[model samples]
Target: MKPLVAIVGRPNVGKSTFFNRMIGERVAIVEDMPGTTRDRLYGDTDWNGREFTLIDTGGLELGSGIPVGQVGLTGQPGDLMDHVMSQAQLAIEEADVIIFMVDARSGITAADDEVADLLRRSTKPVVVAANKADNAERRLDVVEFYGLGLGEPTDISSIQGTGTGDLLDRIVEALPPASEMEEEEDENIPRIAIVGRPNVGKSSLLNAVLGFKRSIVSNVPGTTRDAIDTEVEFGEQKIKLIDTAGIRRRGRIGVGVEKYSVLRSTRAIERCDVALLLIDASEGLAAQDTHIAGIIHEMGKGVIVIVNKWDIAQEQIRAEREGIYPDPDDEIQSAESYRKALMGALKFIPYAPIIFASAKTGYHIKSILETALKISDMRYLRVPTSRLNEVVQEAVRRHHPAAVTAMKPLRVYYATQTRVNPPTFVFFVNDPRSVHFSYERYLENRLREAFSFYGTGIRIFFRARSSKEER
Candidate 1:
């Protein structure tokens, strides 16, 4: 865990925009509308040789969130504004330093004053940032924010990328000294991102795994805006779980929040050591589900297919079995058949472990963490060089590559384990092209069969041997 720094402001003050600019990606949704950001978005960056985590929060307004006793998170539902304020309040409570973003173009307003008044009561250091300062006049107008009495305001253009260096320097100065920060244990923890279509029980599964309702859970789609990272311990092993916003289909994704979600979800996959691809049990598997699976495959990520909301699907089936369902046209299938069909649809990742779970009921919830740890171990499993070549030789003996027009069959000269975490293997061969796609897949399968490389995708590459190596 790094020192937490939060960005706070009124609606449409370019808080999300400035957050995106600072993190060097559009992780937060940037719209002209107020209250666009409803959850805490987090990113890590280093400035002046110091690394810290930045939190992008929804705008602060009057009576923003629920009272301190009542929170909108977990299973409790709230109005959109209530959720926004609740998220912003959480960001404020977790920050080691707060960056107060005000609008330079709009000048200091009542909303800014309201936010300033709130921060003034906090003991944490506050740095005022006047965003949207595009020109000399706008920059000069930034001085008006000084009336907030927090500190001298820094003029910055979140879009144009100006005057941000000074902002970073100021933020660094406000951060607690290096000695007080949490130890750098991020690299050692295995990150597993729970990803899938909207309302597929991704957040529910997260809450179940942690035995608490930490993430915002609602029936509404796109409820979880940011890729929320939560760290938990499974016995002695510490793991980071990222409950990412839904990865909606490309065509249906709007140019606003949904678009930002898809990007962050994909980024979550790229960063994680393993992914839990949650499928709605009631919905079975949708085309969008496979699309997300394809992404996990292409990224060479370790994956586990979780059929969530199994309780709902089972109850519906029971009703149909009792002839209680009203709609005669709808046929109910057995859970076994559903599992087979779902597994069959994901042939590309046949090695992935599948579990039917009800996040609401805590059914098979314990297995998820245990299975994730087992799979994460495979990602780092390095086979001995000797054992790798032996498996290759046996695989080739059983089924060799087809001969190329009058040419000798492809010779497998040697092989070596190149890397782990999506274990990659390199083989020196007579001709790289001779190892066809099917043959490559066969070798991967054989490796898995020999070593039980469960729940992780493995890579194999054939390379021609150099002259000296040929000797």
Candidate 2:
């Protein structure tokens, strides 16, 4: 519950650059391109031990009609101005204080005046920041912003990090006192993280499941910038659904903002009990898709693979129905071929259940909630000590561990369930170092076969135990 401070300005006014400077990280995408950032991006930072949450918002532009041409002062494009304005307005509503940024190099323009007037009626503490004033020579440019009536503009450079310390001090002074902030109680609920690359229908799937427009959906890739959490009741169970920003490959992630989005998505995975890993059905599996699935495996979280946009794939098959398959019965064979290819590509997480869905048409969408609940229950399944040891003993009898040398052979004395929620087990062995990865994997497979761990990952550990302790 830290105090909220939002950075607001027109397109390409160095708002994101200033945001990155304040947060001390490149969290926002900073390109010369206007409207690159379409959603509000948030981060937390402390100034002189006082902490606050900062929101970097898209450029605010008003008017209902399609914005034509470019602004005279900044010469920045205004396409998608309405959406960007909506994003900014939402940020402003959630913020405790507002930092209105203007371009120092280009000087104030008509757009700046419009934003200034908007802030005047809002009744919030507003700070005017004239950015790109790298040196004392451009300090005179900030004088023009004084006309906005928000007081003298703070001369600073987001890129060079000049005059920002004073701006931080001013912002901290304007924030609400610590006593006024309220603390939120922790809730024990199942959190499902919807994760995938951009344009993979992750947001669409969420909207489909919710049966309403809970999140803003657009054809634009990366439309959802922040990790938005929504709580819903499914029968008697209350579940938390976290809709995260689309994660792009590390190399393709643009400078500043999009990079921070990937970080948020990764954090969501760490917090969730189960993850819905979505892949484009028409495009099939890409290397990045595999990369995302690997992350879920490495995190030891339960997962469900969703092949989204299945309707598109279905249509493609129908169009070439006669050409691809002479017999109508062969459609089943063609479908199996598609599923088999996905299995081969994602062999690492063979435990995950795959569902072919179309968010656009609501095909197989309802099953996702039921499937996630089942997987979550499996993740927390605990096995009794006696049963666990019996499984381990049977596994050992089937295939003995290889000997370290001709004279010394590996021996497992006993095993016990150490924990649940990923179902960890510890095996007491004569020599822990003698156990190899292949043998460990084999034991995991044996455990999976004996028990229905369905959609969750399992962990197995080996520990050396002396004969005296065993006796």
Candidate 3:
């Protein structure tokens, strides 16, 4: 588990600005007006080599300041103070580390001193950041905050990006290392990531597989704001499924927490073994779906296309069967046409296996898990040199590559598998430029046909043969 750091202080003390600066992005809304931040904004921040989640909360006050006639409130009773104490008390309990922010220009207020006294009783580590110290005059004003009894203040101008690195180093020093966190692990577990646009039944799929409510499911879009990871054993294999927030196009991503969600989803894709690209079968494919497939291809990870809401598709097919249909071969052609259309939407990920299922009813859900494991296994497959050469020869015979100028019969001297996990092959050729994309695709197809490397993408590299003296 990542360390949790909570930023707490009185209103208008620049807590949100400090939060946005710490995460290296504009995750929190920073407004000059007080009471602007009402909800909690969460984001990930890495300091030095340690990563921690930062939670920004609204400003706290010791009391509601309700008039005596307003809510029949008496004087400053202990009960009224207890209510305000509970709010700050809750933040201290949840935080692994606390950052008490105060405005250097404004100096310390009665509210700031009240909260300081409360935090002094808690054992949580606290760092006091003096915000808006943009000039030497303001820097000198930070000295007055030492009386709050939270140690010397670390001055920062969050809006101008000043002094944050030094503050981060101090924050990292307060956090515990990863080894002390006791993260659970299983051997050779396949890490599967369910990724798609907003409200595409990703959480529903996770709930169906777990046979319980592992994640909160709702009809609302972008309900999931963080990447929630859970593990389960399917058959003999242990799988770690990471359900990430819905990803939006870069231009459409609004500022604040929504933008941070997109960043988290991108990070999740980079760390997974196989990405299950979920698409709504009812809505078919969209431009955003194609964009996501492009990211997966560029990452060189294995992919599986899951067309969810299959129950709805089957109902539509049943209604269509009642009408006058064409010949059997025409029907087969139509099926192939529809398949090609879906494949065209994900053209960048041509090797991915597409499965139709309904995450709601658990329809074909088992097969989806099985396919992910098989694809992960295939991604790590290594081909023998003798078999690789045979496939190369067959590919050359079918569609020979054009010869480079001044080179005699551009020959491929040998082919060998250089690496697995997205299985890369290197071809030592007499003329590397002679190998065209068409011939390369032909060679890949032949290799796939010879060796059942389905559901896995292959990469090929061509290098010119060394001269006789150099060899």
Report how far off residue 207 is in candidate 1 (Å). Answer: 1.4
Residues 302-385 of candidate 2: C-alpha lDDT, one tens digit per residue: 999998998798777777775453466664676688789989999988999999889999988879889999988888888888
TM-score of each: 0.61, 0.62, 0.61
Q: For candidate 1, report its TM-score.
A: 0.61
How would you encode candidate 3's per-residue C-alpha lDDT over 1-471 as one tens digit per residue?
677788877668788888887777887667776656655567777866788888776544323433212233445443433443555666677678888888889898876777788989999888899989999999888999999998878999888878777788788887776787655555388888889999999999999999999898999988887888899999888999999888887556543345456656776786678898899877888889898888888777888999898777656765688855446586346446666898876765667888878999898899999999998898888888898888788777777777656656667777899998788999888878777677677777778788877777778899987898237
**What lDDT score is found at residue 174 in candidate 2?**
84
lDDT of 2 at 77: 49
List model 1 lDDT by residue over 1-471, tens digit each.
468788877678898888888788888888887656655466788898998878675543224333222334433444544434444455556578988888899897765676676778878889899999999999988888878998799999988989999999999998998887744546668999999999998888899889899999999999998899999998999999999999887656543345457667877897788999999988879999999999899888889999888878867886767956545343234656876897799999998888888899999888988999898888989899988888889888899789776556788888999988889999899888676788888888899899999999888888998878877
For candidate 1, the clash count comes to 0
State model 1's lDDT: 0.81
Q: Which residue pairs show backbone clashes in model 2?
A: 28-256, 28-257, 29-256, 29-257
In TM-score terms, candidate 2 sits at: 0.62
**Positional deviation of residue 103's Cα in model 3 after best superposition, in angstroms:** 4.2
Deviation of model 1 at 384, angstroms = 0.9
